[model samples]
Target: MISTSKHITVFEHQAIKLNQEIDGVLFDETRLKALQSYYGENGVPYYSLIHNGVRFNEYVGVIQVGETIIEVLPKADNSLKGSNEKKRWRDILIDMLFAVGIFDIHSPSNSSLKLKSNSILDLYFELFIKEVEYLLHNGLVKQYRKKEGNVTALKGNILFGKHIQQNITHQERFYSRYSTYDVEHNLHSILFKTIKLLKQINTNVELHSRIGALLLHFPEMPEIKVSESTFEKLVFNRKTQSYKKAIDISKLLLLKYHPDVSKGRNNVLALMFDMNKLWEQFVFISIRRHKEKQITITAQTSKYFWKPESGYRSKIRPDIVVNKDKADCVVLDTKWKNLNGYNPSPDDLRQMYVYHEYYNAKRVALIYPGTNTSKSSGIYLDPITSKEIDKECSVISLSVEPKIREWQKNIYETFNNWLTFGNDNVQKNKNASL
Candidate 1:
């Protein structure tokens, strides 16, 4: 058994900790190389590895090494009285889900499973098992092509081979696998397989046992060992989409570990998701989810700023774009930093200016995480020093706290206020409706 006492201390660079083993799901010297190669962090590594799984590009979260197991604690804490580690982790996961563009994944009325503090895997497992259960109960299946070669019978298509003798038959079956859409796909099957592996690594016997039970629930869903590059190539339609809706949580497990037959029982695989990019996506999704229907949220468009030098285009991509009637109206960017009563960084301001000029946006906005102590509501671009510009800029703070009850309403009000002046669609539609 891998020593439960082993601890690898490291730092979270850009909210990312590089794992030594891309597939083994452990911490070692290679992790340092990964850190140096990926993040260029030269100082002593400050992160602590508690177990096997893909080292996370987790949220503003910390991993604490325990005597028996590891603990994950989120940086965002609530003012709630009697709050424990479990509550903090729960709150953090909820915020992550929100930022991951699945805030409304489950409606308020239908939420059933409970959050536990014992293991972070519990949160992911519960979500995955529940979603798998939902898919099973859903009674809907999808079809896709599954190729096979067998001499048994002619099923899909026969590849006529000169090498095939009467006794030696190599019949390739190019048949559609009539399996359930959710079964053994890149997303769901990986979860099934990961869960099977988790049962082995889990220190919590009860939890792992439950995970084992959950695996049985997915009888038809064969556990698949798929690489990140390979699985990403599959497509899901409207029908299969619902079946694997739990993919977000499933992704956490898939990213953390991959099954390795070479290691036999120790087959673990995990991947990384940049929290910065994830947060950027979440901010836009939150805004888009609440914005007026007439207003369209264009995220990470391919359009980049270009200079006259050598016919090469500079790849400067803004985080979000608001379009009114198919015309770019506002250009916005989200910064994960806490400015702490200071003005937006000069570089950030300059970049926004470039976006405003390139996109011809009337207004540009910079959004940051809103904490209790620090507040920079927004400062409009001064008309005096804007350098004969056609657009104005503002820096806005969004709440990172998960417990805020009116968060969506807060997003709507903030975003709506920002665009009210420049968005002709909102103005045109507002008067007609209200």
Candidate 2:
């Protein structure tokens, strides 16, 4: 049983037990039901309670929900061996950061730096706190003017209406003063709320201690849980370039944790991500870095006619579209799966075909994390009767080998080249140049 234990490790297909009462506290049935619905749609529950036992779903990482602590053992490989622990942590975090749109989260090849101490989440929280602290120590304060209402002094624009009612007694002696506290800044509030949030969800003693220490710097600030999207919209100009790190850290924190919703309205924290969409975005963005002239890459394009629907129909959003000279060149969709299916699962292949049909592209491909099981990296298939019979669809793989150690150049070169050469027009141009 996992109830008594503060933390437990489980591997794939492993079975444990969860009860209505765990750690001497009753569980919220609504959240469990919500998780059940999510798992059912996701296929392969992260944690399922059956007559057999509590099942560990396919995926690896840490899951902390309420008092229940789950430390899932990842699929161990050479990359995860003791010697490669640093790279293992770096790789996982880099990908997670990429998913959350935290591009260039660190500089000077910090991804290659070795960190031996904390778990992935704790490490992130620590780095984030430190980044904010760096900004604070450097005297980069976020300033904004607030409206005023008081009796002593009139600073900024005071409401004469408020003064007329409350300050009537001391009108000659005092005036309203609108003072924006030096300590109460927007960034400080974000950091304060994030730290308060980390305390609630995270159980690591060391991390808690570090967070408490950091909270001292933000002694007097309102605890406001702002919208996750607000962090990404933050802008820091040349004058306050120091706040760049804090803004970046804020984006990651918001991305990592979604505000918790359950029985009681007390705001808590739950961290999760749609790995598949993140992988798709990461692939698109990484390949985009090597973009050559005369070629363009657009992601999540909705211009094409995916279908003709009147009700209960949504426009299809292709993960990426590689274009040449304003024409649709190739349609690419990325899947987070390890490509273990019998043959590029028909569901995925059909979706690619639909993308090709709707967009009038020369080729369509589904990119999956290479597990080395598929013999060919770009396995193209043709010859099904259709309007664009000549067009090809392939299942391509980019090995997410957690072992690669570093984000080496050309990691996506093959895929990028595939996207470029996939266009018959570009190939013809290259041949003519030759």
Candidate 3:
């Protein structure tokens, strides 16, 4: 709504007024209604209804309603100047996604150039197209699927009842259920459905030619309805493993897309990701990829912490657990919000305290994304003695660098330095030092 060009940029938690000119973006009432309807039906947590507009939540990505694009970017600071600032955050979000393996850019083609000039939706669409093109050039895999129909010859198994009913008049024909190895399988079905969707929702002119080529060259597959369970039930081996990236992207696009059956004007295609989850994944992957060979990093490793008298026990899972030589363990909880002057919520502090007790960790810290790189340590106090205890927790801020590689390196070094503090025997003899 910044212009009448149908493209608008908004940050997380930002809202734009509909049918009224606002400072930031001016959303249309009709489009807002379309999104409101979609939200009412889907109940996705990406946005919520406001007075006259919609307020985007913690999810960051591009949302397209009809031909209009609403790009929701991540903001860790209070700087929201103009288009330049929006571009910076947009690029940062995309880089974070790529670094965390949300989408691959290892072997970028010409389509990669469009990333800077286009929205995140276009980026994903282009990636899917690239993946499909790669699959086409390499040749798609064939799987054995059951086929039921009239056949000229006998095959795996014959449906005698159907044969007698349908092929009774035709002496040479037989109704048979047979197995044939071909490209008409679930994988192809998913890919084909995604390609068709791209053709419908994609507005990027640069990708149209490639998409057309995929439609022409890729094997024609039967149309089938795909749901979340379809992708969940998928299995892959060595032969089908190469399709993993493509299928993963397909699942994201296909599942997030909702067609407009009532109006056909505002078909929504959302590619939003929860900022909290993204931050957690980014931190875990960064450390695991760069940490020392002796260090072992695990994520979401759960342990039962509380057991009810007659029900299921509660499990506690830290964002990341770092173990060194199987001797020292460090528990880390990654938070997406920046902690400027405010202390972490009591609930979070309590959660970390529980993790320390359950995991028997040497150290535990809450990780947050911030502009300044610093660490502040705190200790739990004895309830009766009102004195500091040995158990410690720290709030560490890993500086958000423009370059992801440099930021990842800083995360590795910052955590390594923090962990080194626990290794000093002399320091262990004395009170914990900052």
Candidate 4:
């Protein structure tokens, strides 16, 4: 039997010692081994194993080891370690994820999901459950599948060799193959696997009843060995399109889950996201949503930079590129870390410089999460002459707001204003380029 469930919350880069009791929760040996083995197999860099404990990296999410739950949350607000701060960042992370289309919840009624959920895992489980229940309410999609079995009546094509081999003794039975339309298919199989996984790892009492109902009502599908490619092979049409969201969440939950085969002590399920990548996506999507009709906002637009004598060529892609009226382009790179009253790093500045020259961008900026919303301008200096060049790069700090919509609006407005006026030198460069 499992021991009493313990929930521990830690911020990014925080460490928890193994074989120790803290905050009234014990980080026992079994749980630590489970995590260690998981990290060994996946090597995700979500956490690093230390001499005494594990330190979580920039990947923030929830991981379950047996009955123990570890929730690692993102921390951009400095070293303020408090429960209130944890809750605040947790909500912010979820909101950012929602904006970036990570938590693809389709239910109209679930718009306020951030307010009701206790953890990110709970939110995922609940969203998946709702999706499955919706499909069950409407009906499962059926498809034509070829099946072979022994039958009394001659239906489909019958193989004389197999018929004689098996049905010789019983002349009434005929082994025949036929195509029957049914709900059994790869999509349902994936969903069923996700349901079983949720049944095992889910600890939320409120979600238990809903999960049970899904298992009871959902069609029994063949168990499949799910992989990253398994989801890649799926093809959705009109009939299967409704299952897209559910299958997406399923793919995430099923793929990240690693079960404990030895001693069956701890099973780890990590649902972590790289804050840097998430920040980039969130900014791009937010701006795209509210940008002017004439402006074009694209993310990760790649351009071949260095071509080698042989093999693959090097490519450079900025996080976001905005083209205004197809005349001037602005590049924006997002970083999740706080600048803390320091100038941007030289490497970062150099990257922005390349983006400026390669993309011919009117301006480039490194966006950072900060307490105050502000922007600073800097010009590149000539390497030999020590004179300022016409090129300009700026650093913009955006304050995280309480509401996601307000935050998104702030992103669009701030980005729009920056693109319009820019710095004094950037405006001059824009006029010079035109």
Candidate 5:
């Protein structure tokens, strides 16, 4: 549709040929030596053939083997040359050769050296060829090729079709959407697009760390709120539940206390829940702007202690708890799953219920990733009423589609909002007045 056949031919004929030649030269020492002699005596030579006699900033060295001369070009570092130029001289040379059909080239996997073979000039040309191939294959090199009106329209339609396919594929690979490519486009476009989006967002987000952790903790459950009283009691009593104990308690509570609590995939759910909890903690800590908030985020002040209560003598370690600027505390328990669903499973609802009951929290929230169908729906049951609460507990979702940079900004904003809001609320009701 988009002239796939033509694109393939160009890449295969040019890029593939250059790649084969480079690969041959890398493996062969004789041709490498001949190329080395072409560089001249200084071990570095300005090549008008590439960037109009521009001095190549980086040199990989040269070697001579029998009748052949080999010139090796190392990876270019622009900072050393103090130039903002995007294309290296070597890259320019290769693109010119590629345009002239001198030799084809291809980029090695993992950003390694470009490969070439055949004649000495071909080998030298291969360097530029591989770079050009990288640009073309990656969709970074865009050339305006004139086409018939009918063909242009057809091409547009083809591109639209490819975009749809790409979107569908992205939905399938949620964690890796930033690194996929359609048959018509290269993966580099996806990465570049993602990077561009990130640039628009706030800078507070730890782009790499948060996203990496998010991917690591996919298919996460919603956030659960634990009550402040329950939290204090558990903390004071020195008894708590770990992830393992929480699952056992959940199964027992649902099966015995509430028959409606359906036993779903406990093992897989538990793993996801734990991983999500760990990731949330990591993300929260990673992007926290206030140094004073560190203790609360890390939950390091309270020593771990175990006590016998409600069947399991477990160490109840709240995911996060901190006492800053006030005698009251902030408590949060991480839930790793969807928060709202029609006929929501009993186990998930109960888990949050338990947290709220145990901790006497003024506000509890169930955080989740918003979906198309269930953006507004989340479990907000009241601890006192045992009925679905209207909005006592919030159900918030972190966006999955935000650019890495934007995501960071959101995280920073969220943290700032929480801090400002908490401080304002605290000031409104002072203990000194009481």
Candidate 6:
């Protein structure tokens, strides 16, 4: 029974305005009068129809008149470009309209759309901005922190100690520490494990080739030409064809002839070793030749403490040692693990402490792999100097993202910083002596 009271033109489109009084009212006076006149004064009821095919179900017979009329807008026929074209533009437009606090196109019974202060796109942009800021502020290669535990020695065997009276002796033992450096070491260890696996299958020339291909993208290796019998004896048919065999043979050949792949890898390792040696040379040159400030780095250079005067010599090698003048030094040791994101054991810390005491170093740093939250640098207190020194030793964790250039930068910067710290210490000591 709704009837149009007025018409308006907007954007060259005609829209109808209905009388507000007729809202929700069936058989209004105007409609009833029209029906009666159309029926020619007959008492029988006459049905009336509205012109528009679209139904106004909610309002029924009533229509609220307004200055601005409701219009059926034409659909946009043009296609959206790029990403917009991949999705429905109409749906996106509708959502955008809802997001901006415009009229809701959903069910009327539903609650009003609540516009968020920040959209998903805004949040994504913020995250990207933060990542970019981190990359800019901190170099691609940076130091990370690791958590390590104190070391304690193992007690006597209680396997058959039923009475257990005399075995109650207390011995200094170390437990593992939780650190980030351990995590990185573990990651490297995985690479080492993969290398080990490839070594095991080295006898199977075909398998070796496949492994090499899988691990590296270098050119194919020239096939080793040997007598069929010798090849069978050395490689194909073996009682034990495990990875251990491959590693052993590879090591043997590396020590003997210096095979190309094995030799190249060894050379790279040797370079790392040589770099350790060259650090001293670089420092000396930088100071003496270039007239720059004196710098020194510390590493584990001695192998005496690990050896027992009475029993078999322990084959422990210290990772790194930093010496700044006579009094200040920092010792660092690296360990590789097979687990993901593991912390150092207490035994490791004890070993480090032993190095600290033997070398008279001020700090003992235990490095490990870094997780997301543990990317920052941190220091740990030495248990021995807790009362006297307040800060005895430091345990730090570093993050490595596995890029060649990044690795080089990390090594350079780390050594450089160590040198700088050592130089400062030397100056302070010189002033004190004066």
Give the number of the best model, judged by lDDT.
4
lDDT of each: 0.53, 0.56, 0.83, 0.84, 0.33, 0.33
What tens digits encode model 6's per-residue C-alpha lDDT throughout 44-148? 211223442122211101111111112111112233343343233223323332333322222233132222222222221222223323322332222234543
For model 3, give the 10-residue run with minimal summed lDDT: 425-434
Evaluate residue 320 in candidate 4 and report its C-alpha lDDT on the 0 to 100 scale: 92
For candidate 4, list the clashing residue pairs, or say none: none
Candidate 1 Cα misplacement greater than 4 A, ranges: 1-93, 99-110, 116-120, 138-192, 215-225, 232-243, 246-252, 258-273, 307-312, 324-328, 372-392, 400-405, 421-434
**What is candidate 1's lDDT per residue for 53-99, written digit by digit as tens?**
23333443333222122233433323443345346545655565545
Q: After superposition, how far is residue 10 of candidate 1 from its true place, in Å?
A: 12
Best model per TM-score = 4
- List where candidate 6 sits over 4 angstroms from the true fold: 1-300, 306-316, 337-343, 372-391, 414-434
RMSD from true fold, candidate 6: 35.3
**Would you list the rank order by lDDT, best first?**
4, 3, 2, 1, 6, 5
lDDT of model 3 at position 393: 78
TM-scores, each model vs. reference: 0.62, 0.68, 0.89, 0.93, 0.28, 0.28
TM-score of candidate 6 versus the correct structure, residues matched by position: 0.28
TM-score of 1: 0.62
Q: How accurate locally is residue 141 in candidate 3, as Cα lDDT from 0 to 100? A: 88
Residue pairs in clash, model 3:
none
Candidate achieving higher TM-score, 4 or 5? 4
- Count the clashes in each prediction: 16, 6, 0, 0, 50, 50
Flag clash pairs in model 2: 150-176, 151-174, 151-175, 152-174, 152-175, 153-175
TM-score of model number 5: 0.28
lDDT of 3 by residue, 1-434 (tens): 35546778889998877775543446678888888988886577999988878889999999999988888999998655788788889888988888887777435544345656578988888778877777887888889988899988878788999999998789898899999988889999899989988988888778888889888888788889889889889999999888998999999888878889988989988888999999999999988988888888999999997899998999988999888225488899999998886778888988999988888888899999887887777677777986778887788887788888898989988888888864334344335432
User: For model 5, how does the per-residue alpha-carbon lDDT over 1-434 read when each residue is reduced to its tens digit?
Assistant: 12211101011001122112332232223222232334436643222122212232222222222222223332212232312121232333233233333333343331243232222222332233234234433443222323222221123223345445554555332211122122222122222222222232212222334334323322222233323332233321122111122222223222221111223211100001122433355335534533343444444223324565666565445555534333344454444444444433565445445544455444444444333212122435445865654223333445432233454456445544553463233333332211
Q: Model 4 segments beyond 4 Å from truth?
A: 1-5, 19-23, 78-81, 112-115, 324-327, 424-434
